[model samples]
Target: METIIVENIYKYYPAATKKERNKALNGISFTVKNGEIFGLIGPDGAGKTSLFHILTTLLLADGGRATVDGFDVVKDYKQIRKRVGYMPGRFSLYQDLTVEENLQFFATAFETTVEKNLDLIHEIYIQLEPFKKRRAGKLSGGMKQKLALCCALIHKPSVLFLDEPTTGVDPVSRKEFWQMLKSLQLQGITTIVSTPYMDEANLCDRIGLLQNGSLLGIDTPENLTRNFGKPLFALKAEQMYPLLLHMRAYDQTATCYGFGDYHHITFIDPHIQQADIRSYLQGVGFTEPVEIRQIAPGIEDCFMDLLNH
Candidate 1:
């Protein structure tokens, strides 16, 4: 079952000058399956939040159509709102309200009570129980995240939309949050989450790589990496920036981008060996102990590859 369907959705915003419009979403189309975790992976300004607002019926698209839980995003927004849970990119919960008060507020807004959906949020709520009396603004980043999630799930929504749920969260909290998502899948709740962190792509069942308001590709994380057909290598030297420039200027270099301690490069000619790269750098007066090795492409690598093309 397709829990959510988005077809040729378009959204535009006014630019600095009144004569021009910025395209926030450009013909975005995809289907999220029932009980599937679909991730929108990209950097900021990729229109993740814009798309989220459209699906959650908080913002209307300029063109195209979308349906959440079989309700049209524009026309049947009221029905959609009742069946779907949405956690915006920012913390939108009442700051002055205590954690318990915030949860109850959302539940009441949805015409439901926390007690009725206690089982849905039990795993997450327990973590926030000790701080239940604390004001939302006074809690830690992780605690605020938990409280927001609990409130979102208070109504036992059929589909959950989380926009950048793990951004600014601690490493441990990010791990714990993903675990909670996986647990939600067991209960047959569909999730659509967006994040700028490429590493989080692996946590989803399938991911759509979005960039500059367009989707580059959609596939399972494993398949996306497996399909990176070019020969890729990681090169490291004492002088990082200089090495990156040299690699980009190489005749056979298809793509070169810095990846933390090393610069990842893909060869235009697959036959080019790792030894060839080392030799070229050395020939260019790069006397530093250069290290070059063929390495498997990751989600970030795939995303960069897509961006390059």
Candidate 2:
């Protein structure tokens, strides 16, 4: 069963202040399978947050329709809200409230008690028990994040919406958060999480890549990577920026972009031989041309390829 079915969803914002309001989400559509963790992966300003808002019923779409657990977002919003838990990108918990108080407050809103929902949040709440009496604002970033997740799960919702939950947290905390979400999947809760991290796309059962309010592709991480028809390589030199520009200007160099420690390069003419790249770099006066080899296309590589297409 699909926990969520989004069909041609679109939303546009009006101009505010001097800036023109952007098309936050174009006619984007995707399905999140029941009991699975689905990722909406993209960079900042890619409309991941806007889509989350619409699906969670926090905002209505200007076009299309979406349903959460068989309930239409607009027509059955109350029912969907009761069955879905949302954790926004920012930490919006009550700063003055103790960890336990914050948890209780949210649970009460859904007409439940922390004690009654103990089993539902136990996997995450247990991590927060030691500092249950501590103020939410005073807790460490990791701890505060866990508490916020527990509160979202307090009502034992059928589906969970996490909008960039690990954006600013430490790496260890990010790993822990994903583990927690995976654990909840065993309890039959569907999770729809949006992330700016390309690396995290592989963690989900399926991922939808978005850019500039449009969906570029959606597939299981394995399948998406497998379908990348172009061969990729990481090439770098002392003068990186100029080298990239030079490569892009070449007819054989199909695509080039910064990839963390190195720049990723893809060739359009597959038979164009590596010697051609060497000659091109040397011809451009590139000093100490670093290693270049055929590499597997990562999510980031595929994303760049999509943008180029």
Candidate no. 2 TM-score: 0.93
Q: Write the per-residue lDDT of candidate 2 for residues 1-309, one digit (tens) a residue.
A: 888999999999885765776689989988989898999989898998889899888999999999999999999999999998999998999999999899989999999999998998887887889998999999998998898889889999999999999997777888888899888998998999999888889899999999999999999998898999867788767777787788888778777788877888877777766788888877876757557777898887787788877
Off by over 4 Å in 2: 16-21, 236-251, 287-289
Q: Rate the local accuracy (lDDT) of all candidates.
A: 0.92, 0.88
Write down the worst ten-residue block by lDDT for model 1: 273-282
Which stretches in model 1 have alpha-carbon errors above 4 Å? Answer: none
lDDT (Cα) of model 2 = 0.88
Worst 10 residues of 2 by lDDT: 284-293
For candidate 1, what is the TM-score? 0.96
Strongest candidate by TM-score: 1
